[model samples]
Target: MRTSAPAAVLFDMDGTLVDTEVLWWETAREVAAGLGHRLTDADAPEVVGRAVADTAAHLIGVTGATPPPSPPPPTTGPPRWRAPQPS
Candidate 1:
């Protein structure tokens, strides 16, 4: 039996193949430090598994910085990926 080609390939950049959570945590830590906030292990849960925007908001809120301005609605923009074509 032959298998069909995949229509799309998903990448689990969070941790399945590559553990990049540590890098995210480090970046959050760095940003917190810049804001005069000390990031602790307790922050890992909120920072590591979250989107960067969420983490930034968390940091800013905790640091007592003025809330960020609301952004325009999201756009579909360009296609992020294209499936491989049969050769």
Candidate 2:
């Protein structure tokens, strides 16, 4: 079987490439609070940087419309993490 080569890279906004996964989860929790549903940090990382629809769908599956999808907060810090792909 032929394997496909990688074609892209992703970098963290924090520059350290540290798992901002927690940050996204925290933010999501805060946002979800407004809807009267409490989302735990464990549930947040799954939808970071996803489109509103995707986030909404995940939320629907998770808390059932507790957190309305919206634009995430602006990102800050140097670029972190990278994945190179062949062109």
Off by over 4 Å in 2: 1-16, 41-52, 60-87
lDDT of 2 by residue, 1-87 (tens): 899765655644552768665676666777677666787656655677664556666676766564445755434455564556456
Tell me, what's the RMSD of every candidate? 5.2, 11.9
Query: How do all models score by TM-score?
Result: 0.66, 0.40
Q: Can you give the lDDT of residue 26 in candidate 2? A: 67
Q: Per the 3 Å backbone cut-off, how many clashing residue pairs does candidate 1 have?
A: 0
Indicate the residue-level lDDT of 50 in model 2: 60
Model 1 lDDT tens row, 1-87: 999877777877769888998898988889889889898998788888886667877887777777668843443367676777888
Worst 10 residues of 2 by lDDT: 66-75
